[model samples]
Target chain A: MDLLLQLTINGLSMGSIYLLLGISWGLIFAVTRTFHFAHGATFVVAAYSAYFFQQLGFSLILAAVGSVLAAVLFGMAVEGILYRYLRKAFASHLVVFVAAIGTLITVENLIAMGFGTDVKTLEGFPIKVIKIGKVGFNNLHVVMFATAGILFFLLMLYLHRTKTGKALRAVISNPEMAEVIGIDTRKYFLLAFALGSLLVAPAAFLVTIERGATIDLGHWAILYAFMPVIIGGIGSLPGAALAGLIIGLAESIGIWKISSQWQVGIAFVVLVAVMILKPTGLFGFRVYRGKI
Target chain B: MILEVKNLVGGYQNKRVLHGLSFSMGDGEVVGTIGHNGAGKTTLLKSLFGLLPPWEGQILFRSHDITGRKPDSNVKEGIAYMPQGQGLFPDLTVMENLEISCFGLDRKTLKKRSQQVFELFPILEERKRQRAGTLSGGEQRMMSVGLTLMHEPTLMFLDEPSLGLAPRIVQLVMENIIEINRRFKNSILLVEQNFEQVKRVAGKIIVIKLGQIVFSGILDPALDKRELWKYF
Candidate 1:
C-alpha cells in the first residue's frame, strides 16, 4: 500500500510534466497545422536557461519567467522564419519536419557544448518534504500537480471565455473565413506558438528538478507526450491531458509488476492498441473525408 | 465612390483570372456584377479584398488605397466581404463566429455590436450557440451575413451568396441586403447568379466576360437585349 502510494505520488509528478507537454504540443497543432516535433527542445532549453539563471543567483520565480519569455520569443521567431512558409504545403511540411529534427539536433548540441553533457541539477533550493501516513512524498510533486491543474484551468478559461481565445479557435477552424471575419490568422498563430513555448518552460523545470538535465532527454520526453497526442487524439487538449495521466499510471504500475526496461514499451503497446481500436482516439474531431 | 477597382489582373499562381477589370460603387448603392462560370467575378471581389495579388490595379475604398492589404486589414478599413457558399466555420458555434468578427471591438462595444447583429438575423440570435456547419444553407447564409455585420463595415462585398439558397431564403437575403444598406447606409457589391435576385436589390450592373468589363450601367439596359442573358 505504501509502495502504491509512493508510486502514485511519482505518477502525479510524471503526469504533470506530460500534461504541460501535451498542452504545448496541442496548442501548436491546433493553431498551426504543423506539429513542432522539436517542441521538447524548448523544454530542455528552458531547463538549461533556468539553471544558468539560478547559477547567476536569480530567484527561482525570476529564472522561470526569464526562461518562459526567452522560449516564447524563440518559438515565435522559429514559427515566423520556418513554419510560416510551410502553410498550405503539406509536402513542404515534410521539409519543415526535417527542419524540426534539425532544430532538435542544433539545440541539443548547443546545450551539450555550453553546459557539458553531464547531468546538471539545481541544488540547494530548499526542498520541501511532506509525509502522509506511512508514505513519504516530495512537496514539489504537489506543486507540479497543482501547477498543471492551474495551467489547464487557465488555458480552458482563455480558450473558451476570452475574446482572443475564441478568435484563436475560429482561426483554427477556418483560417480563410476567420480572416474575412476580422481575426488575423497570423496574430493567432504567433499567440499559439508563444503559449506553447511558455507551457514547456515549467515542464522543463519539472524534469530538471526531478531527474536532471541532459540534451537527449527532449527526444525521449517528446516520445512520451507524442504518444498521448497520437494514441489519445490529435488536436484535442483534454484527450492529451487525460492520456498523459493514463500513461503515467500505466508506467508506474507496470514498473511494479514487470521490469523497468519494459516501461517505455507499455506506451507503444497502448499506442498500437488504442490506434487499432478507434484510430481517432478519445476526443477526436470527426473529419469528413479529410474536409473537416 | 465607395469602391473603385482599376486594371485589376490576378489569380492563383501565374494563371491570370481578371484582366484589367474596373468598377465603382456609391454610398447606399447596391451594384450587381454578373458573368459566366470563370468570368472573374469572384476573383474581382477577392482582389478588392486583397486575397489575391493583383497583377496591376489600385483599389480605393472610401477614397483610400487598399490594394495590398490583407483581409483583416480590409475589415479594419470598414470593408467586410462574405465569400461564396456563405463561408462560415462549420464547427464553431454562431456566437463563436460572431465573436471572431468582433475582434477589434471591446467587451462593451462587442456586446452592443452583437445585439445589433442579432437584430439583423434573429434566427442567428436564437441559434447563437449552435454549430454553423449544421445549419441549413439559408440559415448558414444568414449567419455568414450576420457574422459580417459584426465588423460594422461601411461597404459589404458578397460573392455568390445566393448559390445554394432556396428562392424564399434568397429573397430574404436580398431583402436583408436592401435593409442592411438602408439601415447602415453601406454600399453593397453583390456577385450573384440569380438575375432576378440581383435585379431586386441592385441599382447598377456590370457584366464581366473573360475578365473584362463589357458593360457598366443600369440593369434594365444590360438586360434589354435577351442575348445578354448568356453573359450571366
Candidate 2:
C-alpha cells in the first residue's frame, strides 16, 4: 500500500510535466497546423538558456523570464523565416513536415554544440518535503503541480474570455474565412508559436531545477509532448492536458507493475490503442470540415 | 466614387481568369454583378477584395491606390467581404463570430456593437451561446452577414449570398441586405447567379462572361433588352 501511494504521488508529479509539454505542443499544432517537431528543441533550449543565465549571476526568476522570452523569440524566428516562406511558396504539407523534421535535427545539434553534450545542472533549490499519509512530495513537485494548474487555468480563461484568443480559434476553425472576416492569419500564426513557446519555458525551467538539462532529452520530450496531443485529440488543449496526466500515470504505475525497461513503451501502447479505437481523440470535434 | 477598378487582370497561378475587367461604383450604391457558373463572378469579387492580387491595372478606393493589398488592410479601410457558400467559423458561437469582426474595437465599444448586431438579428441574440455549426443554413447565412455588419464596413462585397438556401430564406437575406444598405448607408457590390433576385436589389447591374464585363448599366435598361438575358 505504501509503495502504491508513493507511485501515485510520483505519477502525479510526472503528469504535471507532461501536461505542460502536451499543452504547448497542442497550442502550436492546433493553430498553425505545423506539426512542429522542433518543439522539443525549444523546450531543451529554454532549459539550457535558464541554466546559463543563472550561471551568469542572475536571479532564478529573472533567468527564467529572460530564457522564456529568448525561447519565444527563437520560436517566432523559426516561424517567420522558415514556416512563413514555406506557406507562401505553397509547399505541400508533406514538404513542410520534412522541413520541420530537418529543423528539429539542426536545432538539437546546435544545442549540443553550444551547451556541450554533457548534462548541466542548476544549483540546488531549498528542498522541503510534504507528506500526506504514507505518500511524500518534494517542493519541486509541489511547484510543478502549482505552475501547471495556474497556467492551464489561465490558458482556459484566455481561450474563452479574450478576443485575441477567440480570433486564434477562428483561424483554427476556418483559415480562409478568418481572413475574409479581417483577422490577420499570419499574425495569429506567430502568436500561436509564441504562446506555445511561452508554455514550454516554465516546464523547461522546472526540469533544470529538478533533474538537470541535457541536449538529447528533446528526443524523448517530443514523444511525451506529442503523445498527449494525439491521445487527447489533435485540436483540443484541455484534452491534451488530460491525456498527458493519463499517460504520465500509466507510465509510472505501469512501470511499477511491469518491468522498468518498458517505461517508454507505455506511451506508444496508449497512442496505438487510442488511434485504433477513437481516432478523433477524447475531446476532439470535427474542425474545418467540407469546402468553403 | 467609392471604388474604381481599371483594366484589372489576375487569376490563380498562371491561369489569368479576369482579363482587363473594369467597373466602378459610387457611394451608397447597391451594385450587382450577374453571370453563370464559370463566368468569373467569384474571381472578380475575390480580386476586388484583395484576396487575389491583380496581375495588371489598378484599384482605387476613395481615390487611393489599393491594388494587391491584403484582405485585412481592405477591412481596415471599411471594406468587408463574404465569400460564396458557408464562409463562417462554424465551431464558434454566434457571439464569438460577431466579436471576432470587431477585434479592433475596444471592450466597451465591442459590447455596444454586439448589442447592435443582436438588434439586427434577434434570433442571433437568442442563439448567441450556441455553436454556429449547429445552426440552420439560413441562420448561418444570417450569422455570416451579421459578422460583416459587426465591423460596420462602408463598402461590402457579398459573393452568392443566396446560394444553397431555401427560397424563403433567400428572400429573408435579400430583405436584410436591403435593410443593411439603408441603415448603414453602405455601398454594396453583390455577386450572384440569381438574376431575378439581383434585379430586385441592384440599382445598377454589371454582367461578366469568361472574366470580362459584357454589360454595365441600370437594371431597367438591361432588363428591357431581352437579348441581355443571355449574358446573365
User: Which parts of model 1 have CA positions greater than 4 angstroms off?
Assistant: A1-8, A85-91, A125-136, A287-292, B89-92, B221-226, B229-232
> In model 1, what is the error at residue B14, expressed in angstroms?
2.8
Q: Model 2 chain A: which ten-residue window has the lowest total lDDT?
A: A283-292
Give candidate 2's TM-score: 0.93
Candidate 2 segments whose C-alpha is farther than 4 A from its true place: A287-292, B221-229
Indicate the worst ten consecutive residues by lDDT in candidate 1 chain A: A283-292
Give one digit per residue, the lDDT tens place, for model 2 in B1-232.
9999999999898898998988899999999998778888888889989888889999999999999999988988899999987777887888888788788888787788788778878998999999898899999998888888777799999999999999999999999999999999999999987877888888999999888999898888346546677765
Which DockQ-derived CAPRI band holds candidate 1? medium
lDDT of each: 0.81, 0.86
Top-scoring candidate (lDDT): 2
Cα lDDT tens digits for candidate 1, B191-215: 9877778888899988889889998
- Tens digits of per-residue lDDT, candidate 1, A166-270, equal 777776677778778767788788899999898878888877777888889889867866777775577777888888877777787778988989988987887
